[model samples]
Target: MAPILKISGLSKVYDSGFTALKSVDLEIDKGEIFALLGPNGAGKTTLISIICGLVSPSGGTVVADGHDVIRDYRAARAMIGLVPQELTTDSFETVWATVSFSRGLFGKPKNPAHIEKVLKALSLYDKRDSKVMTLSGGMKRRVLIAKALAHEPEILFLDEPTAGVDVELRRDMWNVVRELRDGGVTIILTTHYIEEAEEMADRVGIINKGELMLVEDKAELMRKLGRKQLRLTLHEPLGALPEALADHGLELGKDGTEIVYTYDSQGERTGITTLLSDLSQNGIRFKDLDTSQSTLEEIFVNLVRNQQ
Candidate 1:
């Protein structure tokens, strides 16, 4: 199937002579949740803004649901909904009015039924009559989501959707995002919360310094790059690693009371068996051992650090 959103050689340069995006090419499949992970000043928001037509690209093309974002601006933008990181709603407007107004901005007809469903889905139905200022921070965020969905967009861009929300509200937002994706709305979200992307995204894209570093299936990314560490507690403290075990990539820690071995998780041979046999041959004794695998957060940090 063709991607719902296609970006080819997209580049964005600001008036201040700063390049916010650099030759980014990506394709988001229909109905899939794609998480874009990046550090500050990493062009994530710039890319999203260009796609949503809030910002124009310096070069290349962005196609949204078969419409060119630049040449067919209205048609391309009509299929996209964006919830910005900043809170920019009118404080005096009632929840229902604000969301309804959003739909009209896209030239969509007044559809009370659709608005009500969006409100209820985000748990904002009860607050529909309440003024925007009267609601809490989390509720206001939900209001933003409701407004985004009011137009019934085929693609949604959630930029820090749960920024100021509580833990419970963050989980609630995750459920709402999943529901949107399940209902055939393609989602692309940029979040500082690495765990959110880990929990929700089917595919993960890591961006750094205006360049897309890697984009891959979530599980496959983890498996291919993830590393495992095995730490063995020594029965007798060793001052240093034996010459025979030097090839095992071992580290002596805890004042020489622990032996640490790092290995590729995806490797056909982890070298654990050989290392263990070598340890026995060298008369090295261990009291206990523990194993750990690298997480998505670690992978994200390492990627960003490498780019730096």
Candidate 2:
């Protein structure tokens, strides 16, 4: 099957000689939750803007649901729902009216039943009659989502959807995103929250300095890059690792209370058993031991750093 969204050699260069995006290429499969991870000014939003037609690319082309975004702007845009980072809405407009108006803007026929369903799906049914200005920051963010869904777009773009929201609201938004994906909507979200990507995304894409660094299946990415650490609390303080144990590359902690051995999680021989035996032979004992694997955050940091 063809991809739901395709971007090829997408480049954006400002008149001032700054290139915001450089020969970026990506393919988002239908119904997949693709998360775009990047730090500030990394072109995450710029890329989204180009695909959504908010900004025109200096080079390359984008196809949304088989329609060229530039050549078929109307049809292509109609198939996309964008929840921008900023909460921009008509403050005085009641929730229901604003959402209904958005559908009309898309040239979609007024379907009150469909609007109701969208409102409820976003948990805005209770506040349907309330003005947007009266809602809290979190609720206002929900209003943005409601307006995006008003036209029933096939692809959703959520740019920092939970940036400043509280924990409960953030989780609630995550649930809504999952529900949308389960209903067959292709979701592409750009977020700073690594845990969010770890919890929700099917695939991960990392960008930095206006370039696409890497894109891979989330599980495979973790398996390929993840490292494990074996931490041992020493039974007694040691001045230094014995020469016999030096080959293990053990890093002694502060005050000689702990030692950490780093190794690849995918390795057939973690060297844990050998390290322990060697420690005994060298007369170094440990009080307790534990192991930990690298997190998505750690992986993301490493990717960005390596790209730089």
Candidate 3:
């Protein structure tokens, strides 16, 4: 099947000679959760804005569900639903009224039942009649999600959807997102929280300084880039590593009472057996040992740093 969203050589520049995006290319599959990871000012939002028709690109093109985003604006936009990072809904209107209005704005015929379903899915049904101003910040965020879903869009873009929300609400929103994906909605999420991406994304894309560094399947990325470490709590403090242990490439901890051995998981030989045998020969003994593997956050940070 063709990609649901396609961006080719996309670039964006500001009036001040600031390039917000480089020649970037990306494709989002249908019903998959793609997490866009980046530091602030990395063009995540700029890329999204261009696809949604909120911002013009300096070069290249975007297609959403086979519709040219620029030439066929209405058709492309109708397939997308965006939940912005900030809350910008009308404060005077009731929750139900605002959500209903949003769907109407998209030229979608009035469907009270669909509106009710959206509200209820987001746990906003009970607050349907409440004014936006009276709702809490978290509730307001939920309202934003409800509005986005009111039109039954096929593709959803969530920009930091869980930001500022409590743990419970965040989990609740994650469930909603999964349900949407299960129901055949393609989701693209940008988040500062690496844990969120690790927990929810089928694929991860990393952007830094307006350039897309890499995009890969979440599991494949971890398997290819992840490293493991073995920490040995030394039986005795070592002033310095002995010359015999130089081949191990071990790092001494601050306290000198611990040593760490880092190795690649993809390597054929971990060298753990040799290192242990050498330690025994050198009269070095470990009181205890612990092993750990690199997390998605660690891999992400390393990739961005290496790109810079």
* Leading candidate by lDDT: 2
Clash count per candidate: 0, 0, 0
lDDT of 3 by residue, 65-170 (tens): 9999999999999999999999888999999999999999999999999999988888899999999999988999999988889899999999999999999889
Candidate 2, which ten residues in sequence have the lowest lDDT sum? 264-273
Clashes of 3: 0
* Alpha-carbon deviation at 305 in model 3, angstroms: 2.8
Instruction: Please give the lDDT score at residue 42 for candidate 3.
Output: 93
Error of 3 at 254 (Å): 6.5
Candidate 3 Cα outliers beyond 4 Å, as residue runs: 234-240, 254-256
Local error of candidate 3 at residue 19 (angstroms): 1.4
lDDT of 2 at 239: 88
In angstroms, the error of model 2 at 303 is 2.4
Off by over 4 Å in 2: 268-270
- Candidate 3: give the clashing pairs: none
lDDT (0 to 1) per candidate: 0.93, 0.94, 0.93
When 1 and 2 are scored with lDDT, the better candidate is: 2
- Give the TM-score (vs. native) of candidate 3: 0.92
